[model samples]
Target: MTEQKRPPRAIGASGLSCFPIGLGCASLSGSYGPSDDDNALRVLHEARARGVTMFDTSDKYGNGHNEELLARAFGNARNSVLIASKFGNMAGKDGKVADNNPETIKAFCEASLERLKSDCIDLYYIHRIDPAVAIEDTIGAMSRLVEQGKVRALGICEVNPTTLRRAHKVHPIAAIQSEYSILYRAEAEDVLQTTRELGVAFVAYAPLGRGLLTGAVQPGSLGDKDERLRHPRFSAENLPKNLELAQAVQQVATERGCTAGQVSLAWLLAQGEDIIPIPGTKTLSRLVENIEAASIILSDAEIGFIASSIPPDAAAGLRYRAEHMKNMYL
Candidate 1:
């Protein structure tokens, strides 16, 4: 078999060069279940060895345990990789709260730096915009971190075009992290355009649709403790309908002689050069499969066909329930 070639380069807004494919660390912190720290460390090491330079994590993940885990995994090699962690989504008295107060941002960055065992974070995001606080105020705090040499660049997660524009005025956003996949194209078609116009990189989280596009999640695959089980799209009624979309992905994968996950990721990479898909997985084999997608190039016609097969609204159920959805795209 012939070895497939990887895609061309995409530069982040901060001028940091990275592989078009990134490794999201959400699943590594036990999003699905109790994750084996040793196995997670091995996966992170394996991904770095495979040329994946961008690593995405969050302070809220495992309540800071994830950052500590990355510290152990990267150790001295931390400088070789770009660590992207988020702030603002801290749990508080009112349950989960979005806080971008200058004090909170400073405290979060310091804590994250300590947890990651790094002197500076490569890409630091606000995580979510605190609706109560102005976007400029939040970004102003992030900008200070850049001036202080504690953060390399700024990023915002799940913000719309308007919020992005407002935030950019305060600081040049190096990247905008959002949920983008064949299963979710609403933002890619619109918000992504704005990011492109602003010279900001689009970091796609859950690029494989939280394991749905992988063809590995069947009905009742998630445990009761799994947060995905409570998501509307993964609910019993919507599971069958969503599985139909996965079937279409499977058919396309069969034609390409690759896993459905690979086909889905390949299609995302084909979207544009500025888009980087960070698909998360705990297993080494799955991580390898996700990375190999970077080399699976699809022709224009193939990309169009896949897009038509799974239109933005084709998937069943809302991406998130009302409460959770409200927290996003602010």
Candidate 2:
């Protein structure tokens, strides 16, 4: 397969430039649906073949299975890839999420390094901000990892401007990861403004609206085994309304002769060069399609039309469940 190479984008000013689109590895853990190790490894290797150097994973994903999969896929080619992993979000015996304390930073870093089979991580993010612990203390401990050369740069996910400022003050944040896409933007855009102000790069996860904007998922099509079924946006009542937004995306894709997913990603690429999106996939074809999105340049008018098509409130339901939503943008 011929892979298209696009211009690189920076991760803050940390001096790391990767392909415009990074590969999200959450699906490898079957979070979206069941996927085998073979296909997961294939997707990672294929991503590398296509010049996709950035691979985003977290220790919590598949309970460390995702990181191990990445290690297997990039064994000898580790130096050629940029691995971004996260800490925080500890799983209790009952599978409940817990707060991240400053004392555990070293242990988390060591565990992640061992799981990834890498001496250092390119970008390490705090998966979610812990409300109980001061952001300064968590960031202070993370800075120590950078000082020890265990992590090249630091990042945070689902953070608000206030939290971002507090964390950055403790240590310069190289990037901020958040759920950003046409279907969902109000909160992510708010966070984007702060990151741009601080010259921190923004990494957009779920850039395809969690597969809703891909023009493939229909109302109630997500199986019971899929994790998205728990999401309000994919509920029966909300699915129809959310799929309408996909229709608008499809219209633009038809006009541009591209897939709806590509149109969605293209619209994001037009947002800014500093914004890098990691659209995940369990299939090589979908991975290629997402990478090819980098080449679909949208005109100014088209961009405006796309933006107008999916307003911030166009989609129905919250991005996550009530309990999980509390941890975002804090």
TM-score of each: 0.97, 0.97
- Tens-digit lDDT string for candidate 2 (41-129): 88898889988989999988998999999999998989999999999877756665655688887898899899999999999999978
Model 1: per-residue lDDT, tens digit, 1-330? 123676545555687868879999977888877789999999999999999999899998999999999899999898889899999887777775888887778999999999999989999998878888888988898899999999999999999999999989989999899999999878667898799889998888888898888878889778776789877888889988888987878887888788999989888888888888999988999989888888888877777888888889888988889788988887
At residue 237, candidate 2 shows an lDDT of 91
Cα RMSD (Å) between model 2 and the true structure?
2.1
Clashing pairs in 1: none
- Candidate 1: which stretches are off by over 4 Å? 1-4
Question: Total clashing residue pairs per candidate?
Answer: 0, 0
- How much does candidate 1 score in TM-score? 0.97
Candidate 2 stretches greater than 4 Å from native: 1-5, 93-96
In angstroms, the error of model 2 at 170 is 1.4
